[model samples]
Target: MTALHCDGSLTADRASYGGIIRDDNSVLGMELLAILRGVTLCIQKDLLRVSIRSYSKLAVDILNGIVSCPWSLQALKVRITSLMEQLQRKEIRHVWRELNQPADFVAAIDTGDGESFFYPPDFPLDLVELIKNDSDRKTYFRTPSH
Candidate 1:
């Protein structure tokens, strides 16, 4: 369909930089939590429709920016404490930076493009695919609620 074609062309894979990488573990973790929530929202929103095509990638880029930081653990503790007090949010993960990079990269860039030219990398795949595949089988948000 004309609309589907247009939407497909402007998918989440077109996002830009994830954000200023912060090495703080606490802040990075909290940021990651926010990002995960945002990503879930995107998946549920059925963005691959003509309705949001024009601003789709920007949405994704912003989400990636929130979740993919490289802040330090000490800085993270202070940052997370301040963020929690300010936003009333909590930090969830305590994982290493290397473990999170793939998710970060996929969200910020299309995996199909290949990395040499920053087109897309073969080693890294889209995290959205994982989310879509793992989603509830009978509950696509795009479908009319029963």
Candidate 2:
């Protein structure tokens, strides 16, 4: 249930990085819902790009349903509806597990039950290194920089 994010600009700089630890794990639907909720909190802008590792097909369907016709049990409708409205411009895609190892590592860390944490821009050295490697790996598709 941990969330990490960073934002910086030419004149000013900012970073929103944190992690949330749930008490325990559950089914795939609940897990996906929890992660989505965490991600919504981390967003700083109207547009967002997301990459997921588990339950790829299910995740895509859920997200698309939110944008198109959001329907869920009474208990979950509010959260899903809110997220749909909040996300004005977004792209959600499933990626290889190897590609998301860093995020998985962060989420897997034990931050204590119901505990949360935040880090500076350069914190989590291991995760940063993984990101660098993934960006450079040839098997990972990349478009030339403009």
21-55 in candidate 2: lDDT tens per residue? 43222334464665566566656543455433443
Misplaced by over 4 Å in model 1 are: 1-72, 89-127, 137-146
The TM-score between candidate 1 and the true structure equals 0.25
Candidate-wise lDDT, in order: 0.38, 0.55
Candidate 2 off by > 4 Å: 1-25, 43-55, 66-74, 120-122, 137-146
TM-score of each predicted structure versus truth:
0.25, 0.54
Clashes of each: 13, 1
User: What tens digits encode model 1's per-residue C-alpha lDDT throughout 30-108?
Assistant: 5544444443444456432211111223223333244433433334334433433333223233333334444444446
| Model 1: lDDT to the true structure | 0.38
